[model samples]
Target: MSKTVGVIGGGQLARMMIPAATNLGLTLRVLAEKEGEPAALAVTALGSHLDVEDVLRFAEGVDVVTFDHEHVPQAVLRELVARGVNVQPSPDALQFAQDKLLMRERLAELGVPVPDWARVVSSEQLARFLADHGGRAVLKTARGGYDGKGVRVVRDASDADDWFAAADGEALLVEELVEFRRELAQLVARRPSGELALWPVVESVQRDGVCAEVIAPAPHAAGKVADVAADIATTVAEALGVTGVLAVELFETTDDRLLVNELAMRPHNTGHWSIDGSTTSQFEQHLRAVLDLPLGATGCRDEWSVMVNVLGGPATGAVTDRYDLAFADQPTVKFHFYDKAPRPGRKIGHVTAGGDDLDLTVFSARAAAAFFDN
Candidate 1:
C-alpha cells in the first residue's frame, strides 16, 4: 500500500507539491475550504482546514500530515496530533512561524540577530515604542499577515490608533527599520530523523511589498556569507525543533551583518527557482522531509538561474494569449501557472530561466515576464 500525505491549505504551494508527491509514489490529499483553491482542484480531497471533523476525517489512513500555510489554529493541530496523526513541523515549531512576536522572542532567546522590536497592545505602548525607536517603525500583527497585508510603516504616534483599529485594537509588533544593503534568503530542510540540508542563498527583490524576482546563488555574495546564512538557518531549525523546509528571510545590514526578518516553515517563494534549476527542488525536499525520506541533493544545476513572479496586471483577459506569444519566442523559459482566476496584483504564475551567464538568465526572465504583459 502506498503512503498518503495530508496537506492543509490549497494554494500554489500545495499545487506544486502534487507533482513531488506523485513522483515519490505518495498519494496527496488536501484540506481546503472551497473548490478551485489551487491544490483542492488537484488533490484527493476538499475539506476545511478549520473544520476539526473535516480535517480529522481527511487525515484518515494518511501516513503524515503537513501544510502549505501556517494559518491553521494550534488547537486544531493539537487535536489532530492527539488522535495519532503525524504533523510535521509540529505545532510547537509552527507557532514561531505563525506569530511574529513569538518568533522574535524565540530568536532573541536563541541569540539570533533580529531587528529591534517591541510588542504593543495599546496607543500608550505604541507611543513609547516610537519614542525609543526614533518616531518611525514597522508595525505588524502578531498573526495572520502575509504578502504586504497586516503590515504598515508608521512615522507618527497617531498611526497607532489606526493600527489598533485595523487589528480590532489588539496587540501588535513594532520593529525598527534597519539600513540594509539587500535582502537574502536561506532555505533548509529538516527531517524527523534529525537530518538536514541547505540550499544556495538567493537574492530576493521585493516590489510593492511583494516578491518580484529571485536570483539563486546571489550575485556578489561572499562564500563566507553563504556559509554563515546556512549555518544560522540550520541552527534556527534545530533550535526550534522544526521538521520540514524552513526558510529564513534575512536583511543584510550596511555593516555586513545578517538579521532575521521572517521565518517560513514551508517551501518558500525564495526557493521556487529550484523547481527547474537544481538537482532537487524545494517542493521535493519539503515532501521528503515531511515523509522522513532521505533528502536529495541541494546543488544548483547551473551557474545562474532566475525566477520571476508573474503578478496579474490590468491586461487580465490576454494572459493565455500572452503565454502563447511569449513562449513562442523563448522556448527555454519554464512556466508554471497556478490555474487561478486572474486578479490585479495576484500571483498567477512564475517563470524560470537558466544559463551559464547570470546576466543573460536575468534578461531572459525579465523579457519573458514583459512578453506576458504585452
Candidate 2:
C-alpha cells in the first residue's frame, strides 16, 4: 500500500514535491489556499491553514502531515498533536522555525555560533541597542518574515518608530550588523530514528535580501569551514528533534568564522539545485525522512552545479513562452517553472546546470534564467 503525505501549504515547494512523491510511490495531498494555486495539480483541499476544523479534516486521509512553509499557527499545530495526528517535526521543533526569538534562545543554549542580538520591546530599548552596536543594527519581526519582508536596517530609534508604535507590545529583535564576506547554506535531512543525511555546503548569493543564485560545494569551502557548517546543522537537527529537512543559513565572516543567520524547517530555496545536481533531491529526502524511510545519498553529480532563480521582471508573458529561446541558448540547462504568473521580483522559476567547469555551469544557468527576463 502506498502512503500519503499531506502538505500544509500550496506553493512552489509543494508543487516540486509531486514528481518526487510519485517516484517514491507516495501520494501528495496539498491543502491549497485557493483554486489555481501552484500546487493545484496535486490532490488539493482548499482551506485556511489556521482553521483547526479544516486542517483536521484534511489530515484524515494522509498517513502523515508536513509543511511547505512554516506559517502554520502554533495553537493549531498543538491541537493536531493533541488529536493524535502524525505531524513531522512536531510542534515542539516547529516552534523554533516559527518564532525567531525562540530559535535564537535555543541555538544559544546549544552552543551554536550566532551574532550579537537582543530583544527590543520599545523605542527606548531600540535606541540603547543601536548605541551599543555602532549606531546601526538589523531589526526584524519575531514572526511572519520571509523573502526580505518584515526586516529593517535601522541606524536610529526613529527608524523603528513605525514598528514600535504598531507593534502592540510585541517584541522586536535587533542584531549587530554582520559584515560577512559571503552567505552559505547547509541542508540536512533527519529521520525520527536519528538517521541524518547532509548535502554539500553551498554559496548563496542574495539580491535585495532574496536568494538570487546558489553554487553547490561552495567554491573554496575547505576542511574546517565545511565541517563547522555540517556540525552546526547536525547539532540543531538532533537537539531540536527535527524530523525532516532543516536548512541552516550561515554568515561567513571576514575572520573566517561561521555564524547562524536563520533556520528553515522545510525544503529551502538553497537546496533547489539538488533537483538536478545531487543523486537525491531534497524533496525526495524530505519525504523519506517524514515517513521514517532510509535517507538517500547527498553527493553532487558533477564538479560544479549552479542554480539561478528566475525572478519576475518587467515582462508580462508566461514563463513557458520563453522556453524556446532558453532551450535554444542553453540546451543542457534544466529549467523548473512554478506555474506562477509574472510579477516584479517574484520567484517564478529556476535554471540549473552542472559540469566540470564552474564558470561554464554558472554561465549556462544564468543565461537560461535571463532568457525569461523579457
Candidate 3:
C-alpha cells in the first residue's frame, strides 16, 4: 500500500499538490465539496469539510490528513485526532488561522508584532475602537474569511452595522488600519518532528484586497527586512506547533516595523512562485513536512522570480484559448492554470518568470498573465 495523503479541501492548493505527491509516489486524495473542483484529478471523495461524517469517511483511507485551506471546523478536526487519525498542523494550531480574533490573541501571547486589535460584538464597542484608533479601522469576521471576503475598511462604525446584525452577537475582529509601505510574506515549512526551513521573504502586491503579484526575495529586503520576516515565521511555527507549510502574511509598515497581517497553514498565493523558481516548491515541501520527511533545499534558481496571477480569464472561452499569444510573447514564463471557470475577480491561473534581471522577470511574468485578462 502506498502512503496516502488526504487533503480536506479540493481547491487550487490541493490541485497543485497532487503532482508533488505523485512525484514522491504518494497517493493524494482530496475530499472536495463537489465535483469539478480544481483538484478534480485527485479528488477521491465528494464531501464537505464541515460534515464530520464526510471528513471521517475520507480520512479513513489516508495515512495522514492535511489541508488545502484553513476552513475545516475544529470539531471535525478534533474528532479525526480522537479517532487516531494523523492530522498535521493539528486543530489546536489551525484554530489560529481559522479565526482572526483568536489569531490576534495568540500572536499577542507569542509576542508577535501585529496591528492593534479588538473584538467587537456591538456598535458601541466598534465606535470606541474607531475613536481610539484613527477614526477608521479594518473590520473582519472572526471566522470564514479569506482573500478579500469578510473584510472591509470603514470610517464610520455604522458602515459595519449590517455585519454586526448578521453576526448574531458573534464578535468581529477589528484592527487599526495599518500604514504599510508594502506587503511581504514569509514561507516556512515545519515537520511534526520540529525541523523547520524558510524561503526568502517576498513582496506581495495587492489589488482590491486580493494578491495580484509577488516578487521573490523582495527587492531591497536583503538585510533587516528579510531577517525579521524569517525570524517571525520561525517563531510562529515553533510556538504554534504548526506542521506543513506556514505562510505568514506581513505588513512592512511605513515606519520600518514588520507586523503580522494574516496567517495561512497551507500553501499560499504568495509562495506560488516557488513552483518555478525554488529548488523545492512549497507544495513538495508541504508533503514532506506533514509526513515528517527530510525537507528539500530552499535556494533560489535565479536572482529574481516574479509571479503574476491571471484574474478573470478571457471573457470568452477558456484560458487555453489565449495561450497561443501568451506563450509566444513570453517564452521564458511558466504557466499554471486552475481548471476553473472564468468569473470576475476569480484566480484562473498564474505565470512565473525567473531571470538574473529583476525588471525583465517582472515584465515577462506580467505580460504572460495579461493575455488571460477578461
Candidate 4:
C-alpha cells in the first residue's frame, strides 16, 4: 500500500511538500482551517488543524503525521499518540519548539550557548532586569509569537505594563540584546531510525522584523563556523529526540560567538532556497525523515542561491495578474506563490535565483521581488 502522510497545517511549507510526496509515490493530506490555504490547493483533505475531531478523522488512514507549524496543542498531539498515530517530532520533543522559554531552559541545561535571559512577570521584575542588562532588553511572549510578533524592545519599566496586564501577570522572558553581526540558520533532518543530515548554513537578512532574503552557504562563514553550526544542530536534534526537519536559528555575535536564537521543528523559511539550489530540497528531506526513508544528498546545485520573500504590498490584488509580467522577463528566477490572499507584511510568495556568482543571484532575486512591489 502506498504510504499516506498527514500534515497538520496548510501553508506554503506544506504546499511545497506535495511535489516531493508525489515523487516518492506517497499520498498527501492536509488539515487546514479554511479553503484556499496554501496546501489546500493540492492536498487531499481540508479541515481544521486545531479541532481534535477534524485532526483525528484526517489521521485515520495515514501512515504518519507531521506538521507545517508548531501551533498544534501538545495535549492534542499526546492524545493522537495515545491512539497509535505516528507523529514525527513527538509531543515531548515538540514542546521545545512550541515554547521559547522551555527551549531556552532545555538548551542551557544541555550546555548549549544562548543569550542571557530571565523570566519576568511584573513591572518590578522588568525594571530589575533592565537595570542589570544596561536598561535595554528584548521581551518575548512565551507562546503564540512568529514573524516578529509577540516580541518587544523595552528600555524602561513603563513599556512593560501592557505585557504584564495582557499576560494576566504571567511570566514573560527578558533577554539581553547582544550586538550580533548577522543571523545564520542551520537546517538538519532526523529520521525515526536515528539517521541525521545537516545542510550548509545560510545567512538570513531581516528587515523590519521579517526575513527579507537568504544567501546559501553563508558567503564569509569560516569553515569552522559551518562545522560548529552543523554540530550544534545535530546535537540539538539528537538531544530533543526529534524526528523530521529541525532548523536552528543562530546569532553570530560581534565577538564571534554563536548563540542559539530559535528552534523550529519543521520546514523553516530560512531553508526555502534549497528548493531550487540543493540536490535535495528541505521539503523532500522532511518527508524522507518523517517516513524513515534513507536521506538524500544535500549537495548544492550552484555555488550560490538567494531567496527573497515577496511581502504583500498595497497592490496585492494584482498579484495573480502580475505573475505573467513578473516571470515573463526572468525565466531563470523560480517563483513559488502561495495561494494566500495578500495582506500587508504577509509572506505571499518567494523568488529564488541560483548561479555561480552570489551577487548576481541576489540581484536577480531582488529584481523579481521588486517586480511584484506596487
* Top of the candidates by lDDT: 3
What are the candidates' C-alpha RMSDs? 1.4, 0.8, 0.8, 1.3
What TM value does model 1 have? 0.97
Model 3 — which ten-residue stretch has the worst lDDT? 317-326
- lDDT per residue (tens digit) for residues 1-374 in model 4: 88888999988999999989999898888888777788985566667767787888888989999998999998889989999999998999999999999999999999989999998888888899899999999999999899899889999989988888999966898889989999999999999899999889999999887888999989888588898898889989999999999999999999998899989999999999999999999999999999999999998998999999999843746677877777887789999888767777889899999999888888899988888787
TM-score for all predictions?
Answer: 0.97, 0.99, 0.99, 0.97
Query: Which 10-residue span in candidate 2 carries the lowest summed lDDT?
Result: 313-322
> What total of clashing residue pairs does each candidate reach?
0, 0, 0, 0
Q: Backbone clash tally for model 4? A: 0
Which residue segments of model 1 deviate by more than 4 Å? 166-169, 313-318
List, residue by residue over 263-334, the lDDT tens digit for candidate 3.
999999999999999999999999999999999999999999999998888899877889888889988899
List runs of model 2 lying over 4 Å from the truth: none
Clash pairs, candidate 2, are none
Q: Name model 3 segments beyond 4 Å from true.
A: none
What lDDT does the true structure give each of the candidates? 0.89, 0.93, 0.94, 0.90
